[model samples]
Target: MKKTPLFAALLGLFGSVVVPIYAQTVSLQPLWESDTTLRTPESVLYYPAQKALYVACINGRPTAENKGSFIAKVGLDGKVIKLRFTENLNSTKGMGILGDKLYVTEMAQVAEISLSTGKVVNRYSIPEAKFLNDIAIDTRKNIIYVTDMGSNRVWSLTNGKAELVVEGAPLQNPNGLLFDNNQVLIGNGDGSLLAVDPATKNVKTLGKVTGGIDGITALGRQAYMVSEWGGKVWHVRADGTTELKLDTTAEKINSADIDYNSDAKVLYVPTFNHNTVKALSLK
Candidate 1:
């Protein structure tokens, strides 16, 4: 049968709709940024129960013995509630919350804090961990995952016992971690995004090279917002395509460990050296 003009017109219209969906790119709209504080904020974790944000501040060097670090509580409207919500920590970096407990990564140990009283309840020391950078919780499995950047290893804690689970080049100084659907998503310091099967420890590369990825939060199923330590943000799509969303390298505004409010489509970014937490709208 011969191709008719009406058929060709319909085909063209269909192509136009499908192409844009696959080619869609993500962009950020600045919503609100918190006022600069004396605390050198490194990561932001959103608490849905209280609808607030918690920031981990490394007051001085990111070392084991630096005891000047603290955590801050911030409102969604970009107001600092308590600059030092918890104090006397050692170079705290990333955070994860489960139930009434908030888990945070210090130089070589993970601290468990009470959400209600804001007090450190217990500490889990990782003997071989060096520069533990990020934390993720497997709520369903009752497991906690953390990345050790200095050791290029990923550790898992179950029943209060921590063990090195994944290591070597595949992790490549892994810095950011997220547990979704029983899978562990990792962002490396060498700009690579990877997915790992927690049960089998099988690893798969998700996308091409990225910046020195610090924090990672899910945008959708396979989509994620990744923050680079050198002040850049990239939106990684399901098909392994990465789009640059924000850059502040020239200003030296470090986009450190980030968190996302999925329901509100908000991305919370902590500027490590700038001492500020910025909320960007993804709507």
Candidate 2:
């Protein structure tokens, strides 16, 4: 049978449609896991510029007196460059880097540490904040946002003053937060990922998970990777549906406050109680 022009055209059309749909399907491939030196690690931030990772370690309970918290600097190959790169903090959790400063969430205050010296330079506190869980910064406006899981509120800091952004009902003890452009992504305690407009304060449900969402990383347009503290990683698609990609709950390995390097398509997850960080390649 000779290949007809019409059949060839139809085949090319079908191939184009199928390839993109197949390419959209993504999964996690385990790359490497760090040593147990990361005690109670809660968050991992992949710094592309430096080609390294920052792991926030809450050595013990996230309480006011738990001053054993520290941040570890890890190489991209899952090696601990410095086990205690920065030490003597109170229950540090999430972290964000802007310029030469690293901002971290303490139990009740946001600690600003100088990246150059690895020393606490400033503290941003909200008198009523009980538990400050995550930090997200807007580089353009130089504003920092934080989530208070205990008080179920969201806040922003500018010019060294803290102000309420939103709280209560829809908040649901918001845990994970990501500041992406005009909208803020909040991972609620109720397992729903809400996208809130920063200007109008309107919110929209993007997706949901089985448990409280702890970490969120965007993978291009309308695609996201979210994690539950119970050790589940889910991929949220453009249609508001979710697929569980990884589950370590049975193994008791947490996936807390994960970060991704877009250029490398690698996700860096900090395992809280397991005391380690794992890297997974997005395939």
Candidate 3:
């Protein structure tokens, strides 16, 4: 890996230390910013299957009864392939894919869209949900774990039935979720990165950040990148240490839900209020 002078010293210590030392002093260089067409883009998903990116656009308010939301397909190099790959959505936020289905959060429900056709094929509603935000999928059993930030809860959907995973204090405003290494990684409203064991439901704090978490994705087994809704992106390590990688709060640009193209080494960020997705390359 190429490293700057600062990172070279950091990685040098990794050879002697027993604990893994990842690239903590990671730098972000602006690569490209999409045109102001993605209104209130909430989440960005890098779909390796199609070699494209899927962006969930919350065109209007993030509330029910607003079915004007849609999904946009973007090229890997930051070009608009098809603006409206899927439409007629309701306050779309987070998205995850299972096989040929693209499951997206629609406030109080989850809409399943066909990846090939870009047509919504199934709608799973959670009547008891308040604000269903981000989603993560456990591919082993095909379970969909979604977070309800408004109600401070997490739910798992399988075989067309929804079941509560965890709720309340430990999950303060659970927002972003990721399924990695047999664990459901949650980005909490209270700025905590937690890992939950599905069988035991044991919650363990892996790290903590400054503000509420909105996006959680693993860079690798030992490192992750999490973003705050208020425009701060953090690089969190397995040892529970965090470092600020980006902040646009002063500019009032929000990083809602982020996706990283590992092959390109670029982080795709959805600036909610700014109406653009900025790709920042990891250098």
Candidate 4:
């Protein structure tokens, strides 16, 4: 039997990969917009104390001639505040906050920055990783979990050393990661949300999402996910119920992150494709 060219390419990407066996449907909506100034936004982190959302922009492709990545802070009213430039970040994706430290993951390393200066504090390297994308921190356990897109595996890090915690899994192009309570939620590029047990490497299908899942953030009992192709942000309950909280197909929202300001009742969404940020009011 002759293998299709596309199938062959996918096989090279996933190492003896099988095409998607099943797919689930998704519905989405748009909550707000930055209207201007954002280039290839990848993730969003809401800072309630300052009532701002930080947007991480992927300035160039991994192999593109330009070698720069940036982070921008936007107010709820759609005001763009360009934060310090993250000088050498490569193929950047997820962003997480721990106290005053901001952690950003790019390709094979995690870059730690000072929130005040946006200066690179330290760069943590992950060995044996093919393509590292999103990262989730479990403050309760003092551990961090990162997903590898090239290997379809999840790694665990503590005090900076990384070890393969989950291997030979069904994750397809895993991108965003969120650790809440005792579970780790992974968003895959194929449009699926998976619930994983870090201690066991056991996985359960939570729900099917549309578009390519990029970044996810958990607030309260609900987990919010951003889709790169669906161009929307979705809110899903831990129990697997989903709702289209915001739609930005028109704005070209590709890759997104969320920062929830509970007191202010606002949600910050950074659209990568549009190079702008969208602030959504929860009220």
Candidate 5:
């Protein structure tokens, strides 16, 4: 059972090979760019079942008056399939899909659309909601969480009612939400990322402050890729370490809400002002 020099050298080589897989920094490269049919595209949702991309287009400023908003459907090959699949929404932003229904945030309301028929089946209004942004769904619990950046609150919807779950500075204008396991992870507009207990509302900070965050996607079990409204993407590790992955602020590519296909290792980003969805490969 004694250790030999050859064994120690082999172990060292193995460590060197494995450590970089977790610690090495990787950059995203553009795979394909979709057509500019999405007006003020703010969020992208990939439907694996249908093999299509759903984009939430704000169309105008994030206000109720911007009734020109709509959702566009695009193919994975960067082709525009439907420019106005669901039209006449009021400043739609984030989106979440549960079952055959697609949930979207529109100003002070959440609209549920039928994925099969492509129609708005129902709308749930939040009495005090202001600037509802990103959304996440806890499928196991049948709960939907939405962020109201202007109101500094996180709204939860269950059984047909919307209620305020958490509010104030710890939220810091929460924008992106992700339901992982039994917890909800949130990315704030003020550049803070946190994990929250849905039932107790206990928050645990996950990463250091970066730029204004807009979308959050899980990179693996221990890390995430956070997109900022300022056109930057950051990688946040489980231990709260962060690294810049992409920066396009100088080119003015506004990285709004993002979606990821874990199986394909692809990242879909909606460019708010640019009116397009860009696909990048994390590999």
Candidate 6:
């Protein structure tokens, strides 16, 4: 593959590291925001089964409600409703829903909440993990993969028991993850995309990004990555070349995830700093 000029610019931008490039699109806007006092919204997920979107937020300081950090549900039409908080869930980050259960990871624990009631159903304490940043689930194996940002490791969990899958490796600041086919795709905050082997548990650098990436979501043959500090979103092809997909220079976009409603061909994205969701109609 030919080296992209953007690749060289990214390395220079971050001083020997890949820097995430922010998405630039004039049409991006706010879809929803919390009515609560929370300021820093971190991660978001869509629960197709429940027809709701789950948003996790942190106050950034030790507060009562945040000490028990919370997740809220917003309707597809932008109505926000506060949900129940899971006990001991501080600094809650990325969220994912598999089957009928909603899963969220905090500092070192992965908690499963009921889909119907929005109540905490179970909590799995990962002793070896220090900062569980994000999670990806393998429905076929009934296992959840988690990123330990503090320890620089990725772990796999089955039936609430955690096991080391990759330990003390070079996946520095690994944050966002997705499972594609049999491969695990991880987005490192330092601006690199990684493809990991589930069987051998090996990882390879797929490509480099220019800004600090915070979230990622795969859509068909493409992937959308969010630049937390760079204030953008990018469309990455399977071949590793990337382009600007969305930009929030006007809105200050942060973390993001994309879900394509196939029938409608509309892409839904939940953004962090701006505290809203957006949809791009691909007609």
Each candidate: RMSD to true structure?
3.3, 3.1, 4.6, 13.5, 2.9, 9.3
Model 6 regions lying over 4 Å from their true place: 1-39, 62-66, 82-88, 222-229, 249-252, 256-263, 266-270, 280-283
Clashes of 4: 11
The TM-scores, one per candidate, come to: 0.92, 0.93, 0.92, 0.79, 0.93, 0.78
* Strongest candidate by lDDT: 3
Candidate 3 residue lDDT tens string, 1-283: 5668767777697743334556346789999999888889999999988899899999989988898999999988778999999998999999999999999999899999999999999999875899999999998899999999999889999977999988887989899999988999999988999999988999999999998899998888657899999999999987788999999999999998998888889999999999999999986
RMSD of model 1, in Å?
3.3
Q: After superposition, how far is residue 68 of candidate 3 from its true place, in Å?
A: 0.6
- The CA lDDT at 178 in model 1 is 91
Residue 48's lDDT in candidate 5:
91
Q: Considering summed lDDT, which 10 consecutive residues are worst modelled in model 6?
A: 18-27
| Candidate achieving higher lDDT, 1 or 6 | 1
Q: What is the lDDT of every predicted structure here?
A: 0.87, 0.89, 0.91, 0.70, 0.87, 0.67
lDDT of 5 by residue, 1-283 (tens): 4658876787788863244334756679999987777889999998899888999998888887989899998999879988989998999999999888999999988999998778999999987877889999998888999998888888899977988788886878789999885788888766888888878989888886577789988877668889998799888877787888888999998998998888888999898899889999996
Expressed as tens digits, the lDDT of each residue in 232-269 for candidate 2 is 99998877888899999999989999999899899888
Q: Model 2: runs farther than 4 Å from truth?
A: 1-15, 18-23
Model 4: lDDT of residue 190:
77
**Residue 194 of model 1: what lDDT?**
87
Summarize candidate 1's per-residue lDDT along 205-271 as a digit string, tens digits: 8875556789889876677889898899998888888888999999999999999998788999999
Candidate 5 clashing pairs, residues 3+ apart or interchain? none
The worst-scoring run of ten residues by lDDT in candidate 5 lies at: 15-24
